[model samples]
Target chain A: MKLAYYPGCVSRSTGKEMDVSTRIVCAALGIALQELEDWNCCGATHVPSELVSVGLAARNLAQTDLPIMTSCSICYSNLRSAALTMEDPQVRAKVNAVLTKKYSGAQIRHALDVILEVLEKNDELITVPLKDLKVAPYYGCLLTRPRGGIDQPEFPTILEKLIKTLAAEPLDFRLKTFCCGGPIFMPQEQAAEDIAFLILKEAKKAGAEVIVTVCPLCHLMLDAKQKALEQRYGEKIGIPVLYVTQLVGIALGLNPDELGLEMNAVSPMPVVEKVYEKMAEEA
Target chain B: MAADEEFKQEVLRLAGPEVLTCIQCGTCSASCPTAHLMKPSIRRLVKHCLEGKKEEALRNETIWLCTSCQLCTVRCPRGIRPKAVVTALKELAEREKIKGKDQAYEELFQRQIKDYGRIAEILLSGEFMFVFPQGALQSMELGLEMAPKGKIKLAVEKIRGRDEVRRIMEELGKG
Candidate 1:
């Protein structure tokens, strides 16, 4: 019922819309999200050293004992890896040394895992099913990769299952667990663009009307960078990248405005309108 | 010469012995989405680390280019963590003052967090523009687009627990 929610930096700032939708969906599903008190950024891709990065993660972990739920893939990956690293006696000592609060063991759960569990338990929560919406579940690398990830790394289908539960079609995209060029977005802008272009191109080619993602960075790459990518390749890639929460919220019959659909750089309204049209026709 | 040896030991110490298990299988390189952008590739970086060529590995753009996606880590047959190896090299580069382009952004990131405890996107871009003027012109298109969308914040709002975060970071400095 209740979990410590760690929205991380992007979710608070650039990815605030995703966070908004996450809250709305969770409330609708009866999952109480208690924001971690005094939580800091999870040292995304910018920390100077492993020790400092892990220490920052540990500091956040030390704040709460409840299973930490993170929406950002970078935060999930970093927090999980830090918790795993603290298993080492040396790492534990080093991490413990650098903190006012010491982290012994913290279970990091991706927010998707939390929602998936809720959906599995109760399938009737889907009041407004997206029967005709075809969505590609883009996991990106961090959500389901690394050691002790939530699902199978190479071929994750948990999001696909969730999509099906919402009565939407989930495409078997080849790059489901692919990297979104998030880490290099700032420094190597062009490289990041090229990678984003490839992901958007592939998702479009796969007949994905909407590419749903859980990670803010991945969403930024696929959605916010679509215009730049289109200009670079001299082609149209109008596919809308959506947060999983936003899609789930739509299926749950929540208001589109509350879901932060407007916050998306490429408006998801076209896909949303199509879904609405299909639902009305069925009615 | 001894300094180079010292850097090698530091890398091994931070990254651990698992990095030494790399068999040059190229699974990491092949799996890496961004390996094409780098010269030596992640596999070669590990090889360089194993050979104790600390300077070469640290100086390579590959170290900074890693996105920490862990795709290579997941695909590596030998259970080696190529991402951690890159992190170690990045730390080594920071220590040795080799100064990769990524390091500049990393420094800016750290400074922003230390000062405000949270990143104010608008301020961050403004500061980034001042620091990397060439990039400012290039990224301006993206920045201009994000401003009206409510994605970029115009003001810096410090987190509620700045003192606590400062204390934790101070402890790290003492290390």
Candidate 2:
């Protein structure tokens, strides 16, 4: 299967691991990701709030002929929201008019939807089972909110299914869709820190050694901000925040470094080392 | 009496008539994650907005602390969208130029949209470091340590859409 991949901005930079691991895992699954040529930013949370129609149109133009695949949660939401909005005739007319003026005809699909479709089609690719891995799947806000398609706005089942496919138990946590305070980081740093702290705290309480996420923004806010959150909250959140793709790569027996696992603020080595020990014991 | 009336009118304008519908059920405040940090309850803030007590609602930092996840909106039995109410209050505050510490973050976001046309990592990290002084050193250390290890890219290629993004921002009147 072929997918037009959109790594978004964060994945191109700080969240490169998400891009790396996603490519590795997809390759293992025999999925070809043809990156969309000269793709632009998705306008994220800001554009949608300000100019909904234009934002949707701009995103639609970036998509190629094939279905779109993204690693960023915010990017996923923005793309999904745009696609959902364009489905409405009135919205489609208005957005299409704008898009036609800017660029030529275009269409888009949410990365999560694409990922799920790929997994469904090639369920057998998850050959190496991820045994005894307790993953607390964190959805954050974008993937699940503001009324969209694919998953329920508040509660999503996609990540849970993906985790289960890899043979891991998905732990239930109250703050699954809770904001990692990604948007608030600049305007309300302390508030953002507190929010992240609370989410990590909840994940820890829920018995998750690793928090798997689909969004690069959530990954950045949770993984990158751990030290600051711990310093402010006076508690260490030892759980490693990982991109779901990275876990899939690990399960597929890909090299850890190739997945860019070391770039994470919270080192995933402890978890990986433990998993390896268990695998060795079983062997 | 006139001042009290004006206050009530302002709150009513901001929160809408539904603010009066609040039964002080404490549902919003109870469910709020940052409730412990708030001095007055979010319920009270909504009540104040409903009563045109705009000053009290805008003065409280709790309004900014809201994650806007709409959890309270779901929890409200009377269909009071406290998050929206808080947002309305925030808009009022912004129009009034009631600057909060985090206002710079808004500027930073604007800068991203206006100048780069995209959210660049180096720029965001620079902004983050500027806002949090400790981040500056940490980021520097990270740059020095991670660059050689290939964990950090010294110069990442900026998308050509930077100018296009700028034009888009200008068209939106945000640039």
Candidate 3:
């Protein structure tokens, strides 16, 4: 499987580990990730004008003939929604007006789409079983939203299915599809942190050993700002947040360093060590 | 708040006529995470817009509080996109120059995105501090924590095709 990889802004900046692990895992799955040349921002929810956001996303879509894959849920949703928005002739014409090269509607898929396709075909790819690991599959807003989602929008079990593929237990997390409050982090600090706190507290209560986040911003909120969330909420909720690829990398027997597990703020190292211990004992 | 009176029609045009499809089920506000924190919840926002209550709708600060989760969009049995409706409200608010706490920050954010095509966390924070000093300071500690870990980028790389990016911004943002 080959794809045009558009590692969104956060992937390069705050979520570097996601980019790394995604590349590594794609390589392992014999999937080639062709990085989109001169890709700009996905025109995150912050973009001022709807037309500008569509045009910005249209630029990247027009750049690749091949199906584009992004690890960040924000990028995935923006790209997918842009492609959908272009279905309207008026909107398409308005969007195409700004494009140096007109957008012809490219196929946009999340990295999980390709990875899941490969994993579904060949279960042998998962070398380490991650047996008994209780993973709360965090979809965090975008991976499947706005329309034409990979799974059901309100209730998605695909992440849980992926967890089961890794021989791990998928916890019944009620807040799995809830917002990580990443977008409002700066403007609505207390609200964003309060929402993040809810997710962390729930994960801890549900006995989630680790949370596999679908979006980079989700990782930043749940993992990077975990200390701050703890400080603000006045509680010790320390469930490690890992990129979906990072968790998949773990089950593939990849090294913790290769997965950038240490870079995770909440310290996923203990979870890594536990996985390794289980693997060693199984051996 | 501007009492444009055309606010209802404008929102309908921007967000689609699905605004009229709302059954007032309250599912949207119920599903919304930050709805409780906002002055006018999602359901009420829809009601206010339909009722042509401009100030109660657009100036509510609820539109800005939206995380764009789309839970309201997906969960709406009437297929009304509360997220898109609220986003359209936000866009309309900015276009109308109706300012608020979050709206002011959004303008700064849009300016930064226009500048670099991508955000450099530290640099953006520097400009952001002036508008939102408290919010900036709150994230500063997180920045300090992540900087040593090589997570936060000190400088954001401008894309090679930034000229095209600028043209897109100039054209579409002119609206």
Name the top lDDT candidate: 3
Give residue A101's error in model 1 in angstroms. Answer: 3.3
Model 2: per-residue Cα lDDT over A123-233, one tens digit each? 776645677888998987767655545577567788888888777889988889777876655556566677778889999999998999877767866887677667767
Which candidate has the highest TM-score of all? 3
Q: Interface RMSD, all models, one decimal each?
A: 2.0, 4.1, 1.5
Per-model TM values vs. the true structure: 0.95, 0.78, 0.96
Question: Candidate 1: which docking quality band?
Answer: medium
- Least well predicted 10-residue stretch by lDDT in candidate 3 chain B: B118-127
Q: How well is candidate 2 docked (DockQ)?
A: 0.26
Give the runs in model 2 whose Cα sits over 4 Å from its true position. A46-49, A52-57, A60-63, A84-113, A231-236, A273-283, B1-32, B35-63, B68-98, B128-158, B161-164
Instruction: Choose 1 or 3, whichever is better by DockQ.
Output: 3
lDDT of 1 by residue, A1-283 (tens): 8888987777656798889998889999998889987778777877757777778788889988788887788888889878887898987987786576777798888878888899888888887889978898899988876667788888888899889988999997988887899778877787787888888889988999999998988988888778877987898989988998999888888888999888898999998888888888989
Of candidates 3 and 2, the better by TM-score: 3
Per-residue accuracy of model 3 over B73-167 as CA lDDT, tens digit each: 88899978888788888888887799766887777766666777776666666767787778776778778768777888777778778788888
lDDT value for model 3 = 0.85
